[model samples]
Target: MTLPLNPQRVSVDSISKIKELSGENIKACMQCGTCTVACPMAEEMDFFPRKVMHFSQFGMLSRMEDINSYWKCASCHSCSVRCPRGIDIAKVMESLRLLVLRTNKNYIEPSQIPKEKLKEYPGIMMVAGFRKLTS
Candidate 1:
């Protein structure tokens, strides 16, 4: 879904936080689509990497809030490696995740998992899930 841009709605604080967390110049992104092409999880994302970067550059945090692009990012660094501007896109994705996590809202709640399902899941998988989805 494409969100209409309103300059008045931009949050400078959110943009600063993303930059501080990622240590990447988000504005350096040229909307080249190179990162989108390199991302392995691009096909699974509701908003592709390029669009994510575009929204981020404009400080459109609300547009990003409900999207699965950041969550789906594998953090394989393929996008970073291929970026002409040398932006670490994976770190940006991590920063986005961190922003949500800082709000104390978890993507998954461990306690909500069924005991039977927990027992069926692998130990490493559970650990990884907790690390990724929990605050």
Candidate 2:
């Protein structure tokens, strides 16, 4: 599927778990906005919860940067927990963020991590890096 932006041009690497950890079947989303209402950061987003899914489904990642909703998710999991579709919305966000990070990019302004701290948080990075489910 060649999207307008041509996600193939974007090259979503580093997110080996794109189809694993998230497990958020976009087909299940009905754009009901329940996830938005349940999201703690919906009020501060450029696009509501449903929009995020739309963007991801279409691979229009730039929309995520235009809004703070992605970062605001806070991984509260309220949306996923309450979703009638049982989609893992928070994990979806993480996958989006992970893919974005892969292309040497970020949705947040002034995005940077202190290199000196990489070794300090080895365990945290380890878990985040190997999030893929093999079985």
Candidate 2 residue-pair clash tally: 0
Pairs with steric clashes in candidate 2? none
lDDT of 2 at 115: 62
Tens digit of per-residue lDDT, candidate 1, span 1-135? 222224247888778888999999999999999999998999999999999999888789878867889888888999999999999999999988888887777878999999999999999989998898778
TM-score of each: 0.90, 0.61
Error of 2 at 1 (Å): 23
Provide the lDDT at 4 for model 2. 22
**Number of colliding residue pairs in each model:** 0, 0
- Candidate 2 local Cα displacement, residue 120, angstroms: 20
Give a tens-digit lDDT track for model 2, residues 49-127.
Answer: 8888766655454445545666566788999988888888898877665555555553432224466655666776545
The TM-score obtained by model 1 is: 0.90
Q: lDDT per prediction? A: 0.86, 0.62
lDDT of 2 at 132: 26
